[model samples]
Target: MVCATLALALVGCGASVPSPTPTSNRTTSPAVTSSPETTAPADAAAVFPVGEPREIATGLSAPWSIVFVGDSALVSERDSARILELPAGGGVREVGVVEAVQARGEGGLLGLAVDQDRRLYAYSTGGQGNRIQRFALTGTGGSFTLGAAETILDGLPSAGNHNGGRIAFGPDGMLYAGVGDAGSPQNAQDPGSLGGKILRMTPDGGIPSDNPDPASLVYSSGHRNVQGLGWAQDGTMYASEFGQDTWDELNVIVAGGNYGWPDAEGTAGAAGLIDPVLQWRPDEASPSGIAVVAGSVVIANLRGERLTVVPISDPSTAAASYAGEYGRIRDAVLAPDGTLWFVTNNTDGRGDAREGDDRILSVGLAG
Candidate 1:
């Protein structure tokens, strides 16, 4: 096992910093509004890692996301386009392969989500572009398998890299997807483009009537590459984005809010553009999947090789755990039992592959 003991600490909240003024000739959105401050979680001070991480599953090839279905964990392998089931009894089994997945640089089967009705949702790169499909999950335990693939949404954008492919069900039961610019920075600024935006749709792929634009699925816009989306208990949405050369950001997502992407990487404070609540250097935090649990936003970092915990009360300050111990951390999700599960990405051709290569590790959370 590559697991190791690690300690966690929570730092006191600091003074708020002022937003920077817009300095570039970026287009502004008249309808955009400033993101409101996130409401503090009820148990804001209770969440923290208590013990050493335990390896739940290993030998996964480039696992990207994990979702639970009736206590069974489903994981998506990026390049292989395979969906694996990790049963509680032990060992992993192939649920089925995602057909038509065009496995390119960073494009492939990326995110997995399970709805309350036991339907599985997947975001993958298809032959034409990136798409979201729904599958009927059948059987149970080791016998679990996927039914037919029903394409719900398709042809957003696709590229070798920057394919933002995280999908989740919001507290309101709406399906939310994070899409990257697909290597085209201008796509983020185009209102008609679905790339580089957070989209909200009904479970069956219909645009929600309450969406920012009645005719569009765009909930928010101007994102470079948003890979993480989670909601606090109070319904405050948070998203983590990848910046080009300077900064990566954790932002409070608000409807019709425009995040300065091609023009502003981090906290630009540009007029009419919402600035991120917290910004980190790209090397320190190429954060991917995030889970809002207890009172903290737990982020899995790939390049930084750490798990960053941002207290809900103070979004600006953060604490790190397991830095450089397990190599590249890709996804962080809260298990049904309330534990935090994180995936390692050493075998994704970006990090040093340890003996086990990729793995799913869980740690107990206090309170």
Candidate 2:
């Protein structure tokens, strides 16, 4: 095991909300309005009858991201920089560790994406900054090892907090990354700054020609600290962002849309700024990793201490499940057997740790 730094402070910041941009063009009406009782598990039965969350794995420390290879799931531990493989119906084993990983605050190792060819991709913080590295999976379940890692993307801003770290391959076969503002509100609106932006690139880290900006890798800008990225069946993308104090948001990502961040936290119907489809209080929904299940989107909440379910067709009518039942939900992903697998983030030095805290739960959706 390669020893790595373990500075385990949760890296999200809080600031005063800014005034909305004094501009106009778009309608003042919000694109989506979440019902006030979103935190209550009201409409959970309407979408799908979800069973009680079952424990799949335990004793994980700050697990950040998860991706499946064959029947096993590859998970990243943020502080330890260790990649563990959890095979189906078995235990978890440490496969490899990124020695150069600096796991301070919200930095460290985060986000994992596996390609169709079984190649592994990881986002981690290093000496220079946050970067994406690709590796080949060797051997089989319970005996997997990562081949020599090749750095594909680099030069992203890194901080103790606000290090936006979520990566997913879109339906278009392109790689997409969600980055934070790096604690700098100004970076959210700056086109030249990679901070506070959603970047789209090819598997080789090359700029895609279809990007709104030809010369830049930025797909959308003005995001405060986007942590969750999910896609509906039709390729429509949705992202969850951490707001400065008052609000958190769920946004429908457009090619070049500017999600008003520092200038507007939640719903600002000003021109040139896209409003969030749903908004919540930071305490009620400090949302993180999100996944699309059936026709609804499932979100993991860190501070809200619950799992929020939002239907893509009508996001305004949202509901919650297991509110305060689990401690600080982090990542949620769909399993191959029509189950939902997610991780808890209580062991990251913030929440109240339970007896066997920081676990992974598997839930089945019925009807």
Error of 2 at 66 (Å): 1.0
Q: Give every collision pair in model 1.
A: none
lDDT of 2: 0.79
lDDT score, candidate 1: 0.82
For residues 1-367, write the lDDT of model 1, one tens digit per residue: 0001112222222224343222221111111112223447555663666567999998999999999886789999999999999997878999999999999899999998888899999999998799999999889877898999999999989899999999999999999999999999999989989999999999999999999898999998899999999987767788999989887888778788888889887766457777766667788789899999867888888998888777677554456777778999999999888899999999988889999879999998774
Candidate 2 is scored at a TM of 0.87
Question: How high is the lDDT of residue 141 in model 1?
Answer: 73
Task: Give the Cα error of residue 356 in candidate 2, in Å.
Answer: 1.0
| Candidate with maximal lDDT | 1
The TM-score values for the models, in the order shown, are 0.90, 0.87
* Per-model lDDT: 0.82, 0.79
Per-candidate clashes come to: 0, 1
